[model samples]
Target: MQIENMVAIVTGAASGLGEATARALAARGAKVAVLDFNEAGARIVASEIGGIAIKCDVASAEGAESAVATVSGELGAARILINCAGVAPARKMLGKQGVMPLDEFRRAIEINLVGTFNLLRLFADAASKLEPLETGERGVVVNTASVAGYEGQIGQTAYGASKAGVIGLTLPAARELAPLGIRVCTIAPGIFETPMLKGLPEAAQKSLGEMVPFPARLGRATEYASLALHIIANEMLNGETIRLDGAIRMAPK
Candidate 1:
């Protein structure tokens, strides 16, 4: 799976890990479509990398379909799909006001889990219609999950459930799509320096970084992108949820 000239669509491409991935893929000669709700940011990135930008709400079925079709038409069929659009909220199952609202819980699932699946289905469909590459591979789909998916701690009811659902889907989806030569995988990140982590005190952020044991710091977006590149290059990495976390197990708040 040489990345050169491959077509890729990266959701959440306006910032954080998605932006890093789009830049990385483009650098390696992949034609990229930067998809994001931040239309202006998407346009900036697309302009930077000579890629296309599609403003989209990845959670919507129609939005996902239109974005995929647009990418397929302009960049050729997409052989790489990266589902990086997600939201994280740290709220207890029983909030201060009382039990958390059910819709709040469901919204996280809709955006993170359902959105990932929505994009995957469409991308796989587009990839399947195209001829296989010389290696007999049709495409690869990489999803983003959080370490919370595995070690959900306090105040993560909605976020954890959504990410956990993503982890649960990886294996079965990979198994079903394997015969068609589409690899599906997930990456569960530990603490990273992304905007989602805003509002934390600098000292708290540093303390969290110190918990990573090995690398002993917050992960960079490029670090995540680097592994993504490897997963795409290696054919046997399917159906697995690789932790990009620096071996940190979150503690209960």
Candidate 2:
């Protein structure tokens, strides 16, 4: 779809991949809505991109609904919906501390998996109502997953399960939404320079980067954003989960 002057909504746009995508979309002349739980950070990014910032908890039914309504009312219905809001909680099901808290697992699933579906449903409903373009396309959705979902390492039970659910969601979502002229796709990224990773010591970060077979460096947020933009521009890519990892099939740590 042509991004120029089109409205786009990016969840978790306060930082990292979401922030990069929001900036990229704005640069391409799309009117973007930056939605994040971090109100201050969202405002900062939105201000810089000249897009509106909305404080939203993507996991909540009421919150997600309100956010979608607000974006539709203020920026018009968004043709591009990017699901980037998620959490990565590292914990073992059974460790020295005994069993992990059930809530912890639930939190990861809620934010990473359910939150994605919540937004997708609301966005597709609105976008499907919009007049189809010349190509019979009404909108596109890009979801984020992780390499860990496929090859989860030690202490990644919750995070892995949540992301795996997201991976499982792609093809079915696309198949169902196809008739509505909306396409769905997912990106499974390897280790990257996200804020969470940045918190690690420099040496630790380097060691992690070296795990990739080639390019031997962390994935960049801009690279993820680039692929997302391409997916939006490419009409034939649908119901697919493209791995943005640099040939890194993770080991069981």
Candidate 3:
């Protein structure tokens, strides 16, 4: 889809990858709706980008529906949806602290997996109604997964499962939406320099960055956003999960 004059909804836009994506889209002349649970941060970025900020909990069906409805009423249906909303709480099934709580695991699935599907469905439904562009494409969706999903390490039981669900969803969703000219793609990122990683000690962060096989650095949010823009523009790219990791196959911890 053309970025100019297009409408996009970027969930989890409060910080990290989502914030970067919203900024990139807005900079490209797209009208972006910054959706996030962090009202203050969302508002700050939205104001800066001349976009609208909608406080949303993407994990809830009602919340997702209401936010999407509001965006449609105000900025037109989003032709591009970048689902950067997700949680990564690392915990082992049986940890040194004992087994992780069931609620913790459930919450991870709810927010990461279901939340992704929630926004995706709403965006896909709305996009389907719109007449296709010259390329016979209606809209595009970009989801965030993680390297852990492919190779779940210790203390990543919940996070890995939720992310794995996203990758597993790509082909099926793309096939289902193919006739409607809507594409579904996923990005399984390696350790990125997001707030989550920055929270770790500098030494710890450096250690993780060194784990990458190439470049030997943490991935940048702009790099992911750039790839996402390309995916949206490339009509032939559909129903695939692309790992944005630095050629790193994670080893079990």
Candidate 4:
């Protein structure tokens, strides 16, 4: 479907991949909603993109409901929902501290897996009631996963499991939402130049980038956003998890 004037909600839009997506959508004439837990950052992004910022914890029912309500009141029903609100905390199941805290694993699942489903469920329900566009598409949902989901390295038990759950969610979600004209897809990205990675030493970052089989560098946020736009434009592309990993199958650490 055409993005022009379409109401789109991008979670975790304060920075990184989500921020890039929000900007890209707005640049294409979509009315975007910048949703993030960082209210100030969200507001900054929203202001710059001419969108609205809503503080939301995508993992919580109340938070999701309130965010959806705010967006609906301000921007109309969202035709696109981008799930980029996730945490990537690397931890071993058994560390020097002993067995990993169960809460740590739960937190990862809550934000990365459950948060995605929560937002998608809310968005699908709203999109189903809307009139289909010229392409007979009511909405599109783009979820973010990670290469770690497939080749989980050492010290990534929690992070990898959460992302794998996201990968597992894609096809079933697409099948269930297809009849309602809502498409669902997931993007499993390799190491990117997000703030999280930028925090590392330059040598460490470069070493990580060199791990990619080709291009020998980190993936750019714009590249991910470009693929997302393509997915939104191409209706036939659904129920699939596209790996934006630069041919890099991660090695077990």
RMSD of each: 1.1, 0.6, 0.9, 0.7
Residues 1-253 of candidate 3: C-alpha lDDT, one tens digit per residue: 7898899999999899999999999989999999999989999999999999999999999999999999999999789999998888977788789989999999999999999999999899999999999999999999999988899888899999999999998899999999999999998999899997899999999899999999799999999999999998888899889989999998888
Q: lDDT (CA) for every model shown? A: 0.93, 0.96, 0.92, 0.96
Q: Point out where model 4 deviates above 4 Å.
A: none
Off by over 4 Å in 2: none
Residue pairs with colliding backbones in model 2 are: none
| Tens-digit lDDT track of model 1 for 1-253 | 8899999999999999999999999999999999998999999999999999999998999999999989988989999999898888778878688988889898999999999999999998888887889989999999999999988889898999999999999999999999899999999999888976646888887887898997988898999999999999999799999999988888886
Model 3: lDDT of residue 200: 96
lDDT of model 1, residue 158: 92
lDDT of 3 at 168: 93
C-alpha RMSD of candidate 4: 0.7
* Superior by TM-score: candidate 3 or candidate 4: 4
Reference-based TM-score, model 4: 0.99
Q: How far is candidate 3 from the true structure (C-alpha RMSD, Å)?
A: 0.9
Worst 10 residues of 3 by lDDT: 86-95
* Superior candidate under TM-score, 1 versus 4: 4
| Candidate 4 lDDT over residue span 1-253, tens digit each | 8899999999999999999999999999999999999999999999999999999999999999999999999999999999999999888888898999999999999999999999999999999999988889999999999999999999999999999999999999999999999999999999899998889999998998999988899999999999999999999999999999999998788
